[model samples]
Target: MISAKHKLLLGVAMASLLIACSPADTPAAGGRPAPAVKVSTLATEVVQKRVQALGTLLAQESIDISSNVTEKITALHFDDGDSVTKGQLLVTLQQDEEAAQLSSARADLAEQERELARLEGLLASQSAAQTEYDQRQTAKLRAQSKIAEIQALLAERTIRAPFSGVIGLRQLSPGALVSPGTSITTLDDLSVMRLDFQLPSLSIKAIAPGQRIVAHSDALNDDFDATISAVASRVNPIDRSITARALIKNPDQKLKPGMLMLVSITTSEYDAIMAPESALQSVQLQHYLWIMNADQKAERRQVELGIRKPGFVEIRSGVSVGEQLIYEGFASLQAGSTVAPQEG
Candidate 1:
């Protein structure tokens, strides 16, 4: 809508703005200042090759304590969660019937024994028949067998701990009728914890008893040191992994059974060149790093990486020790870009 002269003035103003914004048209008084960047020198160090796996903490020994016979509990020797020793009586059931039976059997056994003794004396004196003496002896043996069986039944009326452990909550109170195989309580030997984990079968060559492994538990807020106690004899068909178990001492009783643990196992060790993680750039699937060449220019190099730690990453190849790496200002760099080294 404007006149041709006005349009020509507008075009001139746009041309001036473009020239002011252009880097080429701006400064040539002393050439461009070098872009400064933080740098680090690659260094070689020994590092452990670790294999990570999830694991579980378990009691060294654990069992569910239950009575073998159904009977009314007459007495409870220990409270819930009591620490007990091996053979310590935990519960006693009503055993009046068993005791009566045992007493009767003992009396019968005594009578039979005396009768057999009399028959043997008579047989030695030729006063009793051989068949009769043999019969008496067999009668005594049967009576003895009856007494033995009754003794076993009476012993079952009292339940004792099979091993030293801490007992869990008691399910039955005094006077409660407990049936055979009913829930009673749990016992756990927690002085030492067992760590169970699975590892790939391909790493079987490196796994062995006595190998050191480290474990961490969130519940304890501490770390535990353990040693490999066992390794699976065969690989699992479904997962293609092998089960392993380690023994960790738990003197403070902080680690408990069924706790999930983060475990680290050392599979190998080697020396590798490491560089600051900040220096690395990921373009698509490849990792690239900028290195300062002798001419103070950035050279992008693709590298193979291994294990990564806090602020550093392993450089398996494509970079060597004594090389200067650009650790910062990576966004402003490219292949053959000029850079000024800044101390880090």
Candidate 2:
């Protein structure tokens, strides 16, 4: 409903306000007071070519504690997750029958021994026949053999640790009958950790025993150094990969068995042109960076990158050593724009 003259006045005021609020172009773009940027020269650094793989942490030695004989558990010597030493008794089965047999065998062997002694004296004095003494000797031997057999049975009934390690969950309680092949628990040597991983056959030539690898545990949020202990002799026919084993020291017992770790293995080493990571800019799939020329102007260059190192990145192409690079304050710059270079 307003008049056309009033509408023209309102439009003119709005235009004036918009112009005042707009940002002005940089003074440096106008050929004075160039923007200052931090700069450094490109340098070469020795870097290792790395291959990544997923590895599983294994115990140095692991085994399931199982029974070899059918017997009732009479004693439980260790609890779940208990640390045990080699030859330590872990379980005791009902051995009363074996014990009674052993005692009876000893008594028979003792009587046989006395009879043999008496017969030996009689044979020496020419009062008894040699055949009688010889038969007594055979009787003593039979009794000794019987005793040994009983002792062997007792030994089998007594379960002992095969190695020093931490025991897993207790599967059988006291009085539980366990037969042959019945699992009682698990034992794992955690003093050292064995990491197993596979790599493609193409990487076989560069790997060998004693080479170093790095394993990172996301659960622990730490990196562990390990040495390759073994490499497979042949490649897997199905996957065309070779398995490698590395040993990591776990004196603190922080690393556990079956942990999934990210592994990094070095294949080769080479020198690379390196630049600060801060200077690189990305546009879609292409990467770009700014460099300072001898004429004190910013020059944008497309660059190829490699793995990132601490505080820097490897440059694969589009850049060379001895060139000055502007790492910071290049956001306000254009190709051929004047810049005040400051050492970074």
Candidate 3:
């Protein structure tokens, strides 16, 4: 039913198809097989345990400077950021009127005292009535009282530093009217600093006065030491935490009041089995780790964890020392899969 030319063309086509489908006698491009991946193992070791917390830096002592008397400020001796000694004059009020009153009071007191002395001499000689002598003595007492009142008024006009500290910016200038209890400036002693932090009430048992703490601030390049100075007797009902304070020497005056700092206190110490944080694997709600068994196969183990430190995590249970824990290639691992552990 076929012609000779058609049969010949068909035979050539069939031969070409068979050659294309035939298996290769040699391997395909890139002749070498992929090399096996190597995973490193880690041996657990005992380490000292520690706890960490965050806290703040504060000035040990601070106060607001204010005028106690109502008057126009006549002079200011210190500017913002000036360091002053205790009892140094800070502000002087308009006291010319008070000074004149003091002078008048002194003169009146002198005259009254002379008159009282004459009356006493007369009373002793029986030349003056007792009632008249008593009246003169009362007048002298009133004059002395006036002198004392004027002295007190003069004292009120001067504002002096209560303690040695750095002064804040002045709120009032010379010739400004100031009233009683008007804040003129703020003074703070920065030679020493304080850190206030809150701790869980449960940790109060382990903390005490005089214990050392470490504090860090992003503003500062280095960490500083602080000592526990006080602890609250009662825990805050809302937060269930106890307030604590720490004192730190700030000789350089680097630490300031209300500075936010990270504080850490060691609450306790104990031995714990820990591993690199990278070695931990989480499966659902539980933590796990891949370990190489004696047969050189991957095994999954559940772990109970405790406190986590900088580079390591405390293993409360589920593993022990001398065990080979898989540190890498965790994604490629399956239970019972063979592994080639690389030695360090």
Candidate 4:
């Protein structure tokens, strides 16, 4: 079955089949991997904890001035926004009727005094009954009481400032009908101002009277210093906050009532390890950071945190001081991965 020509053709076909089934030569199993990722390191520093809040500036003393007597306003001696001294006359009511009543009482009292003198002369002569003289004396005393009552009415017709303060604009003009308890204007002592704000109940123990605070207002482009004046006796259950008051001296009277301010208070001090805010990482509900070991391998670390400052945060637990922390390029690395530490 094997002629020379046929055998040569069969051998060629078998060689082609062997070449198709065989595996080709390949590269080595392992080679150099991708370059290591570069990251920055952070150093620990001591920091202080501070709390901030929004507050309102208010006058130390403020009152709404009003009239106690119902009458037509006869005169307004002070204009709106004028500074007034204590006991200064601010408003006057129509006193003509009151003055007439006073005059009538005084006339009646004078007539009673003359009658009393005549009764005394008659008593000395034994020409007047003892009961009649006693009645005349009672009439004279009643007239004196009438005079005192009219004087009180006249005093009520005039309104005076109770304290030294700046007065608001007049609410009623001359000839305006005003009733009892009508608000004439507001008086506020702006020499000293106070900021009222609420702090979290948890911070109540840390805050104390006389603690220094910094305040900034949008109305005023500068920051000012204030001292804690008072604290609330009880915590508010609805908001879980405590009320606090701070006094800021306003000698220039630049700050006004109703201005919103930002209050910053130092709550705590510590000598612990702190790191830049960028060094912290979060995974799921837990916070983490990458620590470079002595072998230059990236190690995943869980951390406990404390108060946060402007650019740094206090480390309560986990990493120690002087350890190389990866502040960047965490997305491409895993635990035990090699890292190139960069100074930061």
Candidate 5:
């Protein structure tokens, strides 16, 4: 046990074991370089709050033109798809018989007027009894009433355009027997388009008339502009959404009724702090972001998420403007970790 050579060998073995057991310098602890990450300062900018939905375009004025009486169509005054002005004759039914009756009634009225004049003269001269004169006058009044009734019926036989519009395909042609209430064709004033869409009930407070709206149709390759014309007062109980209508001018007649359109309503706009979408992290069903503090230490912050746009997300709270955040290499970061921010 007291041999010098054996004791020297044991001391060397113990020193080697100690060196192996000691901890190596760790980059995470402090001795090595910190992780390199990209950082950006939070800035305020105007953000548009918008809602989108599928909508249907409607005509400014649309109606199904029909007839009041059942009869054979005698003539179609306007061709199918013809543009008609107000008071323009559109269709004429079997009105020849009615016109003859009206003419006969007018002739009878004229004869009765002459007879009534003779009866008044006779009564004034005492050549006829007062009762006889009164009876003739009553007959003349009845004739006048008959003419009025016939004229009314004749008017019903002629169909005229109630308003200026483009007429759709004619359903009934000449010589076709159409019943009362038969659909003749459609008349639409397409000078403007009305788009109807549904929006969430929660947006009621944010939407209003005169707000700007944009629309796109698969049928049309271009986008068009519109203005919010109305917002429904009542929310649908089943869907929990409200109806909204926007008006778009179609002066060039580019838009048509019943067209399918994608509508986007600009409900609001305001300044907000936005972060790059990649900088966000989700942990335990909660959203968080990595930030570099004044000391260059990484900190994890919980954030309330809002409307997200392309490449960026709105941070509603828990982040301050002018604060710097690590936008890259943040997945490997932890609280209190040192960070080297890279320039943009």
Candidate 6:
């Protein structure tokens, strides 16, 4: 069934097909060109372990300003939100009656002194009896005591700032009657802010007096530096946490009492091996990395992870310093595949 002419043509066609399928220049599998990849040399980085907590700010000194005596307000020296110095006069209540009594007492004391002097002169001349001179002396003492009592009564009507601080809103106007236990306003010393927070009992070792802390106020949109002032010796039984206090310098008086803020404390710090996040690959729950071995070939390694930073992750184990890992372009890589590493 075969013709010589047909057989010759078929042979030629077969030879052309073989030439197209296989060429002498076709590279062998073992000689395949290595893939180009970005690699990073692992190194140790000082890692900081920090803990966060919500804290409340309180003034160093705070008190409710109140009146101790029932009296009509004569003058209010401070307005709402006024800064006052310690011992500064803040209020003057009606003291007309007390002033009159004080004046009368002073006049009486002066008269008593004159009488005592006259008695001394009389005694020197033997014209006065000892009993009579003693009576004059007792009268002088009573007058002095009366004056002291009047002065004390007048002091109750006058109000003064007990400490340097910012005064709160006024509760009573001039001419209004105020009595004992009646709250007049509030006063707070803002030179330093007390930050209160609680930490777990286990973290007690990480915190101590004089330790540094940082606070962030979302309301003020600012950060503040603080130093630990006190740590609770007893842990709360209900929560197993201990309270902590930090002092924050606030000479600017920007921080207010009862404000909520975010606080951070460095629990510990140490050097640890860090791996670039880009080179890390995860499967299920385990993480792995594409490492470049000494032979310039890709090696798949399972690694243990710790804290994660912005662009790097802490390598707890399965990695060491000075090892090279593929930083990028490893999506199509296979174990044992040759790699042409460019430093990243």
Candidate of highest lDDT: 2
Per-model TM values vs. the true structure? 0.81, 0.83, 0.75, 0.70, 0.76, 0.87
At residue 82, give the lDDT of candidate 1. 91
Which ranges of candidate 5 are over 4 A from the true structure? 1-38, 51-53, 120-124, 200-203, 207-218, 221-235, 244-246, 262-268, 292-302, 329-343
Q: Could you give candidate 2's per-residue lDDT for residues 1-344 as a string of tens digits?
A: 99999999999999998786554544565436788899888888799888899999999999988888888999989989999999999999999989999999999999999998888888888999998888888988999999999999999989899999999998889999999989999999999999999999998887799998899999999999999999988899999999999999999899999899999988888999878787889899899889888998889999999988788888899978899888999987989988988766
RMSD of each: 8.7, 9.6, 9.7, 10.0, 6.0, 4.2
Given candidate 6, what's the lDDT at residue 246?
98
Question: lDDT of candidate 1?
Answer: 0.87
lDDT of 1 by residue, 118-156 (tens): 888888899989998788778878888888898888789
lDDT of 6 at 126: 99
lDDT agreement of model 3 with the native? 0.80
Alpha carbon deviation, residue 192, candidate 6 (Å): 1.4
Better of 5 and 6 by TM-score: 6
Clashes of 6: 0
Instruction: Mark the 10 consecutive residues where model 1 has the least summed lDDT.
Output: 25-34
lDDT of 6 by residue, 1-344 (tens): 99999999999999998886673434323446678899888898899999888999999999888788899999999989999999999889899999999999999989989988998999999999999889878988999999999999888888889999999998989999999888888899999999999988888888999999999999999989999999988999999999999999998899999999899999889999888787889999999988899998888889999998899899898877898978798998999887888756
Give lDDT tens digits, candidate 4, residues 122-181: 999999888888888898899989989998888888888888889987787899989877
Q: In model 6, which residue pairs have backbone atoms overlapping below 3 Å?
A: none
lDDT of 5 by residue, 269-327 (tens): 89999888888898778999999999999999999989899999999998899999888
Ranking by lDDT: 2, 6, 5, 1, 4, 3
Worst 10-residue lDDT window for candidate 3 reads 26-35
- Local distance difference test, each candidate: 0.87, 0.91, 0.80, 0.83, 0.88, 0.90
Question: For candidate 3, lDDT tens digit of each residue in 1-344?
Answer: 99999999999999998787655422322333222334444445455444456677767779888778779999999989999999999999999998999898889889888887898888889998998877877887888899899888877898888888899888989999999778889999899898888888888876789998788888886799888999988899998988888899999888788888887776666677777788889878899977777877788899998877798888787877677788767676668766666653
What local lDDT does model 2 show for residue 280? 88
Report the C-alpha displacement of residue 341, candidate 6, in angstroms.
3.6
Sorting all predicted structures by TM-score, with the top scorer first, yields: 6, 2, 1, 5, 3, 4
